[model samples]
Target: MSQRERGTRRVVRSVAAATATLAAAGGTLLACAFAAPGAGDGRPVAGPGPCVPGRCPAAYPDPHGGAVVGRDNGVNVFVGGDFAVRGAAAGAEGRVVVEGEFDLAKGSGSPPAYHVGAVGVGSRVPPDNGSPFLRVGGDLKLAAGQRLLAEDGPVNGTVAFAGRQTGTGTVSPKAVRDTGALAAFDGLREELTAASTCYAYDKGVPRKPTGTAVNQGKVTVFTGDGTSAFQVFNAPFDLVAPDGSAQSLSFRKIPANATVLVNVTDENGEARTINTSAVALAGVRRERLLWNIPDAKVVRIAGGGQLQGSVLVGRRSSTTRLSVAAVNGRVFTAGSLAHESGTGGAGGQTIHAYPFVGVLPECGTGPTPDGGHTDTGEPVPFPTGVLPPGFPGLEGLEGLEGLMGRPGAAGPDDAAPAEGRELPREGPPMRASMAVGATLMAVGAALALAVLFRTRSGPGSGPGRRT
Candidate 1:
């Protein structure tokens, strides 16, 4: 062959080899990018165990029980059975909802002084005699009774009677249905139960109660490391103080940022009753403390002692009962709640409803057990928008920022993009991988073009030379 033709053939061969090499290198880079777990390939990444607050969404699986409490703070007293208040001074900071009959006995010598923020009764309700005054936020439902006696002559809120009203209260003919309020009670119960499960699964340590007999005077303390701190007791125990008064339970050796969960159960596969009449809890915040007693039949907080944190009692099949005097936090029971009068201050019981912050199970972020790629073999196009701020696996790619646009900024678009066209709200797992793959492909394309340009311009095709 002529020199020119030979040179052309050699150039062509060189370009072909370069192209092949570029293709292989690109494929290798892509394989490595996706092979690394959580490189942003779309697969769900296992979350860090015991989810951190603010990092998790405030929805179902990790619904920040505290936030739920904050939203439903309007509800104070929620009873699933017949509710009767006789000669007792009970008041709630929020609304009260009773599923069954509600009877409030009049105080002797003077009008009955029972204060409720708002009252929602499902069945029949008796009229108040205006001791402290009835200032309900919503309508009050009564079966048969005289007009509510308010010191100011009439009750502040609306009143609806079932049969007929004989006294001097403004009665509405139609009974307003407060189904949402009742449903909130049910939802709160479910959420608390779910929270109990999450807390137990994430931070609890399974432990059986020690000492054959229950000690009334001695207190039990459970502590834990920074990450997981909990005490799971399979046996039932009572809460009484050392002085034969109230039991004291304390937590120690816990990290400042850690949570404490206490699980209690009885030998008969039921939740043992925990009496907190004279009990005290030290070095524990209501938000960080969780008591999950799914089999509990009764949770009593009587006497004058203070009890803090969230309590989850009873399961789906059984009804959990609650008897309270003074409590510092929220309580969730499946059955009924009885607030003893004259337990707190000056003949009234106080039960504060605070938020409960429970831990959630760490989501699995690793590869699926089947060990297969999530992609359908069809290439996933690289996502638009710059790498998220502080995105992982992207530190080394900072040098290529000029080509990828500013970090976290969408690509140049004069017109506004359509709504919901933005990146995944929950943050895509495989985003970084897609970016790496795209980068590798871009590099390969550039190399291929350069090889072609060099092959066409070098050592071949001058003025003539002969074929």
Candidate 2:
């Protein structure tokens, strides 16, 4: 062939080869984008409330990074909140991790008892076919062998998913009048504290709320009125900057016999109360750096006691805190300790009471010193309209205790021997380790792609071969 003609043929061959390479790479990228399964659309998705109608099954990003939800097969829509699961429309199975403060709104006047907050479900209906599930508010955690639970007790604002909830660990209130889960939560605390290690579950077992979705039935929050209802800690307490008042002392100096009260009020004049008594104190009070929200201050008191509190306000206002009174400790209250900005979005304002010794108080059964209230050996909500600030509504490190106080050990049974009252159940067993199979598969697929595109010359080809 002529030199010019040979060069032209080579150029054409090169162009054809490059085109083939481009097409193969393009096709592979497209397949990965669609064929490979993703946890969910990396965007904010919502789910149907219990009373709402639609195909039902749906999945949304958990406000907390816990579980995922959706329908399976084509029937049964489920809502997974905290440790339990509830029914929804369609055929769907949802996994939820109820954490933080879930606010419960109630009827103002006429329909006095209607609940209007996120509630925990007991059993979850698995999805049929291979359809995806629906999640609301937060993410769903896959706890392998963990059994879901519907913690229906006095302290109503947490959903936990770890191990199965055995009858021995289920938290229960002593009387219908009590509004805290300290009674039923005793066993769970022993299990956790005994381990000396804890992870944050948006919905811990003790304070699981009632009702599913936002209609039909609702979780009730008692503002210390005619009958005290349940009040879950919607947010952590921000006690960094005190109002500079005598009431705001270091949590350590808080009289051992004194009870701490955290009053959470929303913009609508609606208030929820969370109180825990200093049955026992642990550790020494320490004033450490808590947090600093844009429009708020933060403080923390170090001690140990019956930690209890609630979260109120809007989505941005939910936080957490700890309230405790110890013998040698001084209570240091923070003012305007609510919202703060942090890395990804914002950090929650919270109060930490640490370094004191704990002693379980004789929270005998019957009425409180204030009367009409049960004496669970903790603090009793009073008639004072003046609520305490820096009490709750802030976010912080997981594995920490509640804003009102750290969970205490369960006391011995006080009720008389009744016939056949089954004991509370413990939580499901936790996985020995997280599932990394999906991640490994993705890595392997990427490696295969790399090898496929790699160019190599056969052994017979010396320097460069001409095809």
Candidate 3:
């Protein structure tokens, strides 16, 4: 090979290498530009925020923003009205705040000692603050030995009641009869009602859950789709297994760390009487599940199945029978609660202290959509003043603007941390990553063109051969 031929080969190789570099950088740039904010750098895309129940999507009034349901706010059992004991009610494992009267009288059977240990010792970090695990706004009655969250064994918490106390029971050491613990929950009922409606009728595409929910003769199986972040299911018409010793609900096809929302409604968007056995949802975790009852005028959980998610009821005045059952997550209702939890203890039937950490649609105060059950009407305006836990107020908007050009600041496209986890302290934003990629590609292209032009114009390949 002559000198000129060898030089031509070298130029070809240099151009080929530069072109390869540009292609590699282009692929990375696309990911930075299009992927959900922070996805390129391995941060959580969207989930619950730092505050309980989490912040709403920054773009509030967007009609196309899908559903916007509030969270459980870390309270185990939240009732807007009276909480009366009609049976042997085992107190909740987590925090309990009743807006009205609290009665621990039993309708039948021997009185079982009720226990209320907020954020119980099992698998949860108990609170160090002496916050009340039980707060009653109205009259309190433990006629049949209904109890407060007494400091049992290693569990220590407080209780607060606003009204007169009746009956006899073991109360907590740090009990306050008159206080303002329930003030924060003043309008929470109305806010949750709107959210329940929105979640029930969220109109995002990809209809039909990506999982398989088959209703067998006695059991129902739920398999999740690993691709999506959420595993939504419309539970079977019949929730109870006719045979007592059968697993009524079975979970399968578990998604890769997904948030499951089970909407148990009738064909006309109504609530169903949930009768379950005293068995845990084996595959699903308590923190990641939600049971949404959008139009529940009355929620009755009879027989025995242990409900594994946070339940949200839309109607405030709805009467509820939460007797003789166990719930592993939070329970929110806006009506009178008729409760008798058969047994009370870590091993017995009880309401565990797992807060709901699932991601539902987050919008401003809005009305139910106008159409079928799935109809999504125009979302109402963003809240005006004194926003709820998740909704940011006018002054709070400052938190929205991340550190101008700094990485890790909460940007408009940036998602909140999961389950109150802290946001990353340092990192590059999506735009920064894209900029780096684009620069790399541009440099590679320029280098390639300059080398090719120099080689061709040098000796034998231009309009006029040089030497």
Q: After superposition, how far is residue 347 of candidate 2 from its true place, in Å?
A: 4.9
Report the lDDT of model 3 for residue 282.
55
Candidate 1, residues 369-423, lDDT tens digits: the string is 0000011111111111112333332224421221221111112111122454433
Could you tell me every candidate's TM-score relative to the true structure? Answer: 0.44, 0.18, 0.58
> Which of 1 and 2 is the better model by TM-score?
1
lDDT of 2 by residue, 266-287 (tens): 2121222222222222222121
**What tens-digit string does per-residue lDDT give for candidate 3 at 274-324?**
665543455666567777665545576655556666677655546777753
Global lDDT scores for all candidate models:
0.35, 0.20, 0.49
Error of 2 at 422 (Å): 18
- What does the lDDT read for residue 54 in candidate 1? 15
Stretches > 4 Å off in candidate 2 = 1-356, 366-467
Worst 10 residues of 1 by lDDT: 365-374
Ranking by TM-score: 3, 1, 2
Name the lDDT of candidate 2. Answer: 0.20
Q: What is the lDDT, from 0 to 100, of the residue 436 in candidate 2? A: 21
